[model samples]
Target: MKKITLVFLLIILATTSAQALSWAYPFVVWSGNVYEVTTEEVKNSVISKRIGEVKTKPNDTTGNYYGNASNEYPKGTQYFAISDISTDTAIAVRVKKEKYVKAVFVHKASSHWNPYYYFILFVVAVVLFSLLGKKRFH
Candidate 1:
């Protein structure tokens, strides 16, 4: 029983490590709208008018923000207009919580493209091929 418990614990640890290594898309929901977050270099002149200030709540998770579904922004995040363009579709922003001044782009959500579906399909295909190949040979 002790050996069985040790094996179970090891399996759990392995699975948790694997999950930690997986990457997720960056997203944030604000003002009843969802935006995908990305970064790019923009001239200080292009980062125009002050739009809004980031009011990140205590419950907001800023560290692992990739899969965060909350509407709260990260602490110290401030948004600015992109030249003359500032709309629901696109905007220029800055995240000040990091070590350096980080410029970010907030774009409207496109579609739900969960990559895990493809991984699951590949695993199924491999299993089916192996099973069918073995049967044909026997």
Candidate 2:
């Protein structure tokens, strides 16, 4: 029983650590301004300009701050200036990091894991509980 409990606790810790995020919230600080992606609108046609790349990682990626780095816009993240074709002025900025992309005009990116991750965790927990129980009984 003790072994099973220990194993279960270990599994929980591993899962939690694996899914830990650098930050939470819909806004990120760039330069000295706070940029937030509130609403998303899909445009049939639009223009984009590559502005720059994220150079530094933030000290604290959790809270809101000014003149600080953003977790979503981590180092190596690519910044793109997005503009609507109907308008000449650039309206939104898109930041792409790894497989995720976040921007004001584009679709919002979810911070939570997909349902599959939860399902996998459930399965692993069930399997561990059964196996550990069997071992204890045997």
| Model 2 steric clash total | 0
lDDT of 1 by residue, 14-47 (tens): 8843223222544454443455556655567666
Evaluated at residue 42, the lDDT of candidate 2 is 32
Q: Tell me how far the alpha carbon of residue 35 in candidate 1 is from the true structure, in angstroms, after superposition.
A: 2.0
Prediction RMSDs, each to the true structure: 12.4, 16.4
lDDT of each: 0.52, 0.48
RMSD of 2: 16.4
* Number of colliding residue pairs in each model: 0, 0
Worst 10 residues of 1 by lDDT: 59-68
Once fitted onto the true fold, the runs of candidate 1 whose alpha carbons sit more than 4 angstroms away are 1-23, 57-73, 96-138
